[model samples]
Target chain A: MENKRNSQTIAEYIKNWSRKHSLFIMAYGTGCGAIEIPATLTSRYDAERLGIRGAATPRQADVLLITGYLATKTLKRVIRVYEQMQDPKYVIAFGSCTINGGMYYDSYNTINVLEKYIPVDVYINGCMPRPEAVIAGFQQLQDKIARGEADNGTRYKENLEWYRANQHRVIKNWRMPDYNW
Target chain B: MAREKETTLYIGPQHPGITGNMMVKVKVQGDTITNASVHVGYLHRAFEKLIERRNWLQSFTILCRFCVPEPDPMELTYARAVEEIEGREVPERAKYIRTMVMEMARLQSFMLWYGGQSGSSGLYTLGQWSVGDRNYLLDLFEDLTGGRIYHMYIWPGGVRRDLPKGFKDKALKTMDYIEKRLDEYDKLLFDNVIFQKRAQGVGIIPSDKAIEWGVVGAPLRGCGIKADVRIDEPYEAYDKADFIVPTFEGGDIWARAQVRRIEARQSISIIRQMLDKMPEGEVYNKVPNPMKWKIPAGEAWAKTESVRGEVGFYVVSDGSEYPRRVHVKGAAYTNGVTVTEKILVGQNIADVSFILNSMGVCPPEIER
Candidate 1:
């Protein structure tokens, strides 16, 4: 029993270490904050050196970067994408708007608090955070993943009922297939 | 010939090839598209409604969000509309600065468009190179406005600040670098036979319907209209400088690409002229505090020649802190939806993104 427990610990450490090094981001630049993402991913800042690259599909992505405000319409897609990603995924909410709706706070269509419906592992603050700040935020997520402390995906699974209740409350006309994992 | 059954293909809201968060539903018979429809609203944050809730100055922050790649024109148009309604006089220096900023925006936007256009055709090398080369322009914007993507530099009364020291020298140097780089891009993209074959006759925007469908910018210019808001309706210091509205006769993807190619050259020359002939004076005229400021009740319409086309704003003021109604007419509204749908039909599925990029549609502007 003791030998088996030790082997499991070693396996978990290797998994976390591998996960921290390679992050494929599905950057849904849904708002103004998305403008700077290309700047970060492209030659100038080059997030590729840090093992961060863009994934064409949600299933292949490990990190979901929601850049800027999420309208109710986009929120539906965001939830679907977050669910599609594999386990041990991380979410980075870019810009102040994601935290509390920065400029569009008073706007009727925007979703003020993203954390209410989706699990966010890191939040970058700025009206539209610069590439440097975006890189810093990615670094923070990497640190959390390496420490085995980024468990929002696990939390989301344990509280699926509560997350679903919150998600369904705001997203009217929800017609997504049941994602039985 | 046997009758062929049609199948539907949805190409984005998340596809890497499409410009932004918008989908194109195309009905195809084998490789040829029979019917195409645009489904946009993926990126909609309802800017028109949100602008009504905020005061005049507050609206500036959100205005740039309408068109991400070229935001300065939105800021310039909104500011000009408010200024026109109030009948305020802008400083001589501010007009030149506005022109300079607009040209810089045009230059960078073209760089971004180059990345998108070439990348759509599987020329990822040029996309990477141009996008990285574009960092030079962004660095200049950072020096001038203290922000990279959304400058919020061009506002009512005048600019937020004056040109920082040695800005002209840096801008001129960058322009020279870009001028040389354009030749390299020509050899790689324009002069290549593969790109020529892909873009030459694909996505033809018929000249007669071009005006009726409300197509503007390079697409219109590509059809041989030679119409430019900068020349036709001279705003700011555009009249102060001399520049040509380049036109090509084809109206196909190649023609439109040529127009943009020439315009990129024109932007470089215009910036050099503006810098040399720029008058030194106060950069801004003070407006009352945005928190308590109210303008006389009136309505005004203002337009500017953006990289994509004519971007206009119609502001109605009911003598209140918040605008009564702020309606944005982005260049992408017609191009991304109507024009794109029309041109996309009967083309190969492979050319969908290529033709769309040729039109220079910014998706956020369409839904916003």
Candidate 2:
């Protein structure tokens, strides 16, 4: 029993280590903050050195970087994209808009609290955070993964009903496919 | 040999190749697009409605968000509109500073376009090089204004502050560096055969139909017509500066690219002239307190030539602290929607994003 437990811990450590190193951010420029992503990933900041690269489709992406203020229209798509991302996925909410709707806090279209609908592992607060801040946020996420504390995906599954209620409240049409997970 | 059935393909509100949060629904027959329509509002923040609630002075903060890549021009247009409504004369020195800032904005925005255009065409090197070099310009903006992206430096009466110490020399040096780099870009991008073949014949907009469709700025000039807000209206210190409005004849992506390339060079020269002819005086004319400031009951429209095209702001005041209404007439509204859909039809499926970039279809400006 002791030998089996020790091997399981080693396997868990290996899995977390690999996951922490490769974070494929979905290349969905949802809002204004999308502009900074190129700056962060490109030559000057070079986010690739830290193992953060853009994944073209949601199915392949491991991280959903919600760039900025999401209108109710975009929130539906964001939920769809988040659900499509594979398991062990993480979210880094960028800008104050994602945190508390930033300058658009009172705007009728944008939601104030992003966490109400989706679980966020990190929040980088700025009207639009600089590339340095974005890189730092990724580092924080990497650290969380290393410590095995970045399990918001499981939390999302556990409270899927509550999250769906929040999503449904904003997205009135409710045309999305049912979550089977 | 049966006729291929047309299929509908949705390009994005989330796709990478797209400029921003907007979608294009295209009907394709085999590899060629037969019909196209643009769907916007993904990035809409109800800017016009929000501006109505804020007082005259406070509304400047929100104006800059209309266009993400270039915010200075939005501020300039709104400031010009407010100044017109109240008949507030900006200081001579402030006019020159405003002109310089606008030119700087044009340069950086064109840099972004260079990346977008080249990236869309599979030339990833230019995107990397241009966006990386764009940091120098962003550094200049950060030094002048407190923020990198959103610079609320231009206000109703005048600028927020005078040029900082050693700013002129630093700006001149940056210009020199950029001018040198533009040659390298020419060799790398303009001279390359693949880019030439891809851009030369694609996305053609005839000169006769361009004005009717409300195409303005570089894309208009690309159609062989000579029209520019700076040359035609001569706002700010543009009257004081000597520069020619560059025009090209192809009416295609290549012509638009060439128009921008020469305009970037012209902008550099214009900035140099503004610095040379700049008068020493106060940079700002202080308006009344923000909470109590009210404009006389009137309306005004102001226009400025941004990198994309002519960006105009119309402001209506009701003799109250808040504006009665605010409406933005951005070039993207016409180009991104009507012109984009019109041009995308009959083009190869691969060139949708390519043509969109060449037209400078900024989505936030469209939705805002």
Candidate 3:
């Protein structure tokens, strides 16, 4: 009887939460892993089941999923896009690419690690993990959401050590990116 | 037009005109580009680093993400690189199969390019017909490789499976369908005078500049510089297959489009030849289990004539279960950003997308 009552209250809590927040995803699929994001979010995967849809712009996104690696050429844009996302945004690093430079680790123009640059809440492993795995990641994010764990505001604003270490391998002569702006 | 004394316009990373995850910061005076810096990494997966961490076979699946448009070239290059290290000889039949698959991939990619190249100039029909027509090829890919987009079928020793029963016949029929559709494309795209006017004199890359710019594939060939991996260094069954490296001297978007059109024809011819001359033998030579496959320590550079220019995989192995280094040279670095910026300097804003489309700059290649 208590179990039923608890479940009903939890359902009510979820309903209130859904009405208050519409999850916006930065459906950023960087590599072959990206091909599956569309499949999962469309009718097949129905990311809408969790009230998530791909946002047209980063500023509108509630979550930024780094689906693949962070290369030098793409890093600037990644940073820019991450910045454009609203304050309460959560970053989901979708594949091995986002965790560590999965490949292209030694290229002169590429960055080997992603975690150093962005604060990732979820790391889904797979060179290009399957759509099923992607759905699982989404479910996990939803669980985090159910707990009402909103953005910390401190994590990204204050974190620079990880980003600096990952970029140390690149950035010849250790010239820091202009941060005064 | 020179309004702002010093202005910076960020062109991508979130721009609709550019495909995939990439950004080009272009400083323009009025409409003409003054200075440009190509920024990449939005899609960089540190592929070389990742491949080093994974076993040889696992890397195969990872390789496809390098060039989304023509991923097979990367897969083929990685497999051949491993073969070079292990000294594994692919069966003659497997070679023929590889040749067949490569040409088909080339055809589909070319078709997609044709649409993009034309669609940029407001010719939407070409994009519609070709992209939809491409579904036929994707269907075949799905049936044989189990994945429509990334078919991790080609491996070190050989392909994953022999052509499925009736797969060859179906492929031939698809070829026929594509051939029939090409005329419609020709009429709607290349044969149209507006296309000629819009593409002919735009984005000229002279033969002298071609080599200096490090251009490859169709764009370089379009300038009359004869450089094709298939001719310069034949891999798989390219040596046995009879086809010409199509070239044009126009040195503009028209030339690039023309070279691709002619090359598509060459790809079709090669596909027919491979099917006709396909030898009877096992498609796959058994290799160590993927879970335990360890490559001997060595470094080698493998290049393939992808739909894009010279796609290379420079791999280093340290006699371990995984590669020590695997750096993929996606054509985007040179063709996608560097060259596009150089040529886009004097071009109008309207022609930017058109010229980029003609260059076939798949963004993931740049991002990777």
Candidate 4:
């Protein structure tokens, strides 16, 4: 029992340390907030200094930064992207649209409250949050991961039935493959 | 070995080369494209339908989203359309400021173009340099309008606020800095042999088919046309300033890039002229209270020369607070879709995003 417990502690420490050091973001800019992303990632803000970088593909990404409002069509693609990402994944829902859909709340297309369909680990508030706010949000996510409080990816797996039901209801066409992983 | 078959590939909704969230489906045989289709609707938020629901003043907020990189043109076009419908007269100082803002947006957008075009071709240093330099303009915008990307500064009657003290000095200093940077950029990007070798004669848009395909902005200008809304239909303070509409003979990627580079220089000169001749007057002419405001029934079309090309807005207002219909005719509408499909045929698969970048195709505008 002591040996098993020690192994678990070592695993936790390594996981937390690695998670805090590197964050590969698949910045899906579905709205106006996408414009601020290049500013944050590039030399001016230098998100690389904090070990945050952009991943070209979802397969290699750690965090899915849903930049702004997600239209129904984009929401389908976002789900596919999220499912493709590896385990220990995170979702950083940016802007007011992800919270309650902001100005696009009444729009027929965009989904209100992204957390209903996906487990959002952090929410960055703004009409379109500035680069400073984005950096802060990343900091918060890093802190959460270090504390091992960032277990939403596991939560997603446990509540897979609920998340899938909600996702299927919104995405009408439902052409994508099943998220079994 | 007897027969060559075409294979299909999808480049997008998350592709690095693509500026935003649209996909391009290409059928290729041995690295050469045979047929192409642009799969948009990834970033479509139904802006037209959404605008119909919001009131006149409120609709301005969403206009900028039509094109992310250069948003002031969207704001200006929408504002001008409403102003014309209302027969509102803008103050002289406001006109000059609007002109300066538009020119600033043009300069910053060209910088963004440099980053995207170079970044796609494995020359990431240019992307790093240009995007880093673009922050200077963003800082100016943040100080002036309080938003870096979405500057909701322009309104129907006039701009939201007047220039702050020492705004001109700061703007001139930035302009001077940008001028020096432009020369360095020409050496780094425009004059590079590798870029020239890759861009020259690639993704050629035939001059004869330019009009039929509805190509506008740099793509059209790259085909040796002097067609510019600022010259043809001068709005704001464009008529007040003297500037040339730069054009090139070849309609390839290099030619388009050249057109953009020359236009960036012209924008600098225009901004200088605008600042020097700007009159001292009221910045804004306030409209009615937002909750109770109403616009009379009228239809108006306003077009402005955005960094991309001609950005036109056709707004129909009913005798109510909300618009009857707001149709944004973005330059990228035809460029990103029809022209992209037509031009991608028989070209190299690697140059897909290069061509798209050259055309200044903003995917959100295409989808919206």
- Quote the B-chain TM-score, candidate 2: 0.98
Query: Between the candidate structures 3 and 4, which one is better when assessed by DockQ?
Result: 4
> Candidate order by DockQ, highest to lowest?
2, 4, 1, 3
Overall lDDT per candidate, in order of appearance: 0.88, 0.90, 0.75, 0.88
Regions of candidate 4 where Cα sits further than 4 Å from its true position: A1-8, B1-5
Which 10 successive residues of model 1 chain B have the least lDDT summed? B12-21
Model 2 clash tally?
A: 0
Worst ten in a row by lDDT for model 1 chain A: A1-10
Docking class of 1: medium
Clashing pairs in 4: none
lDDT of 4 by residue, A37-65 (tens): 88888888989999998898898999998
**Which stretches of model 2 miss by more than 4 angstroms?**
A1-8, B1-4
TM-score of chain A of 3: 0.76
Candidate 3 lDDT by residue in tens digits, A57-150: 7878887777666556556556767776766677777666566665555455555566667777777887666667887887767665555554
Model 3 chain A worst lDDT window (10 residues):
A172-181
DockQ (CA atoms), all models: 0.58, 0.76, 0.20, 0.64
Q: Count clashing residue pairs in model 1.
A: 1
What class would a CAPRI assessor give candidate 4's docking?
A: medium
